[model samples]
Target: MSRKNRHEEHEEHADESWLLPYSDLMTLLLALFIVLYAASSVNISKLEELSKAFDNAFSSGISILDKSALIEAEDEQNKSQKQRHEEIGIRTQQEKLMAQEQEDLEKLKKELDQYIDKNGLVTQLETQLNQSQLMITIRDNALFASGSADVKPTAQKLAVAIGLMLQKYPDYEVLVSGHTDDHPISTSEFANNWELSSQRALNFMEVLLQNQAFDPKKFSFIGYGEYRPVDTNDTEAGRAKNRRVEVSILRKYTDSSATNTVLSAISDEANSAPSTTTSN
Candidate 1:
């Protein structure tokens, strides 16, 4: 009877094998939840520490979480480096383009100066290269008679020459502006200096457009009359200087700080230079 009672007691004890598997499943679930929380937090250092802890606890060499985090960090670093390289490349290209443009403008200015010197037109024509534009200034007497809007027949060759030089740079914008002395005019052809200046600028621009290479859309004409004079209108010589035409090739790319510096230098030079009185 005692042996039978002991056997019954052993049978009454619950099966403990299932408890081991259940506890293992609970542990696995907890690990999964921890992994999810770490990944959502985006704290790489904390994630690496957790991976190391999990690796040591499981006795595994390296955890999948660690490998995945390392790969993600490497990818982010590569993307950042690529973006920086692209930005540098773009800036380099822009600098190259700006340098080339400067060279072309300088060359053109040199050619124009040569032409002026060769033709003995230094007294009638002058060229100035500034940060904003390349300006070609011509005395009114070179292109027209006194108070006349018509371009002289002989001066048409000069216009043709300038147009030929400009053909090398088709992309630049050109402005033809006319200025006049303060003397009033009431001729049958022109009511005032404004009308005469406008007609003169239009006629000069028309001659320039005769070249087939020139795009008329890129050219503009304006007349300042006596409003925007380079010299005084009080004296005959100064008035002669004021009565002029200007052809300006506008710059496509300009640095504002550099332009200000150049302008200041030019003003200082003009103030120091000797003033020579020349008549038209």
Candidate 2:
């Protein structure tokens, strides 16, 4: 009975150690929840206090959470706006350039048409304004004598007048191409019409280059003798139409660097040797 009573007394006196830490933990958690609730209520004074406390505890200079991210976002927005403005400016300039080019092309076409109409040279010359270029066509008989590479004196005057007109617009490239009928020739001067046609084109180009306003470097000539004829050789009229000289004027705004490279290459090839005709 005595041992039983002592055991009961010892059990009664045992410390409640678990309750103390658990109560402390509960109080801390309650305080944390109450602080969080106060912060969520948008109390400006409490938020500032919390921020100051954290800054002091962490030894931080700035209080904002994502300063770098906000700055980067603003910078990207500014950059995008600047790019959009630049794109709009470029589009406006391009539109103005296109309009000016169209006006220039129309003026050139009208001048050629008037000249042809006044001189009664409709059968000899014609002009075209297509998407890529402006073309002026001159019949072979009008520019050259039969079986000859030499340009006639009257043809020289016509070419000079055309050159004068071209002088007004010096930015365009001049391409003088020669075409011939299907009749084969084996003369001492020319082995075939290809040689003759090439020479004639060169001769025309030389006359055009004589003008002080025209740039000799931009002039090029090619011969397509009997190969790229406009009409068949079966009929006289068709043959007449087939034998001709053509001058194509390229626009100024069409990839200036790339066009100049191609023109340079063509000039080198034409200077090296006469090109052969391939059937179209």
Candidate 3:
């Protein structure tokens, strides 16, 4: 009775024991599926971060293909971050290039001012470096006699000086704009002040370009007449201020580019340059 009982017990135990290992395997598979579902629902950035954490934790000196998928996921995230950094770097470089161009223009403006003061050209021509362009304003009386479009000999000399100064800098567009006082012009050569002012500006531009040293590609002329006056036409003083010609040097970069795109436009010359002028 004892022998039969022991043998039966051993056979039952052998068959039933196999269920323990099978149940353990099934439980592990269920847990793995649950983990996969959770990971799939996570945001990409956080998923990448979590994968990296797993890589550091499970790095063993064995050939396990288990880490390959996680490593690939982390690598993709790293690549995306690196691309963003590179884009930012390119933008920064472009901004720096624009800033340097602005600085160079400011330096040129200061030189022009010194030339104006040294040659006693004040009351005749004044300089201004603004956001869009560098402007050199010349009073009409200095360039032409009243009711005349012909540029005076003194004005020709002034143009030559300014033209020579411009040659020192890189090629840039030069706009020679003519403006005039509100007074009506009834002259033999012109019908209205507009025609007279425009002719004067064109004549001045011609004088400046005569040297051949000036690049024709960089020059343009426009006449605003009395319409674009700097001052009111109601008074003699206002008319005097309004009757002028302006030579504007167009900058490659605009004000918005420097102020918004670049780090800052803190030009030493711009800061120190005179903000306003007065005629005696």
**Top candidate, metric lDDT:** 1
Highest TM-score against the true fold, candidate: 2
lDDT of 3 by residue, 134-194 (tens): 8899998898887788898988888898888887764777778777876665655776665
Q: CA shift at 230, candidate 1, in angstroms?
A: 0.9
Q: In model 1, which range of ten residues has the least summed lDDT?
A: 271-280
Q: Which clashing pairs does model 1 show?
A: none
Cα lDDT of model 2 overall? 0.82
Clashing pairs in 2: none
Q: Which segments of model 3 are wrong by more than 4 Å?
A: 1-90, 256-280
Q: Candidate 2: where is the Cα deviation over 4 Å?
A: 1-70, 254-280
Q: In terms of lDDT, which candidate is stronger, 1 or 2?
A: 1
Kindly state the number of residue pairs that clash in model 3.
0
- For all predicted structures, in order, the TM-scores are 0.64, 0.68, 0.60
lDDT of 1 by residue, 129-161 (tens): 887788999999999999788999878999999
Q: lDDT (0-100) at residue 128 of candidate 2?
A: 94
State the weakest 10-residue window (summed lDDT) of model 2.
Answer: 271-280
Assess each prediction's global lDDT (C-alpha) against the native: 0.83, 0.82, 0.75
